[model samples]
Target: MNIELHPRLAADCHRLGQVPEGLVLLQRNASLPWFLLVPATPREQLHELDPELRHAVVERWNRLAAWVARRFDCTRVNVAAIGNVVPQLHLHVVGRRHDDPLWPGVPWGQTLPARAYSEATLASFQTELASALDLTPAPR
Candidate 1:
């Protein structure tokens, strides 16, 4: 199924690939290890999804959270599905460190210097993420 990402997500993230549950996207800001899973469904909430799909998405979310924590050596991993701004059913998995810029706080609505990933770095990250999650890379 072809899933169209919300405009805000499309604008702020780089398409990484597809997992069985949905499309995986890496946040544009390279400063933090943030990822999003956009499920291929019209449902606006996680609980509203079919049982099997919901389980698959949650399982993937857990895997992504663990992977992010390990890869980024984070002290904590934050997972949330706040759809107030964007109504699409997307799950956010973020790796956070105590020393991170937004330490002791969330990464929402905070204006920090944007650090974009270099093309080479982004390519490398995409490869590593695919391998780690066994995802099908998005077509070039």
Candidate 2:
């Protein structure tokens, strides 16, 4: 299936790899470990999906959440599917810490300047994540 990511998402993230149900993307911001899972389906809401597909997606979400929490040593992991901006069926898995820039606030609409990931850092992370999740790396 040819899954096209929303322009906004494509602009802001690094294509990591594909899982059984969807693509995984790493948000460009290095300050926080934010990941996105865009399921390959036309359905916009999680509840709209049939049981099997929904279960597959949720399983991926749980795996990504656990990985993010452990990798970032996060105080908390925020997972949501607020598609008001992009209207795509993408799940956000953000790692948060008490000392993080957004602290008590949500990452949405925040003006915190994105700390771009260096080439080595991004590549290393992509490799590690792909290995950890058994993902097929996105094409170069």
- Which candidate ranks first by lDDT, i.e. highest? 2
What C-alpha lDDT values do all the predictions have?
0.88, 0.89
Off by over 4 Å in 1: none
lDDT by residue for model 2 (71-123), tens? 89999999999999999899999999999999889988787766988878777
The clash count of every prediction, one per candidate, is 0, 0
Candidate 1's TM-score reads 0.94
lDDT of 1 by residue, 1-140 (tens): 58988899999999988988889998999888889999999999999999999998999899899889988999999899999999999999989999889987998777766899887876776788788877888865
Which 10 consecutive positions of candidate 1 have the poorest summed lDDT? 121-130
State how far residue 86 of model 2 sits from its true place (Å). 0.9
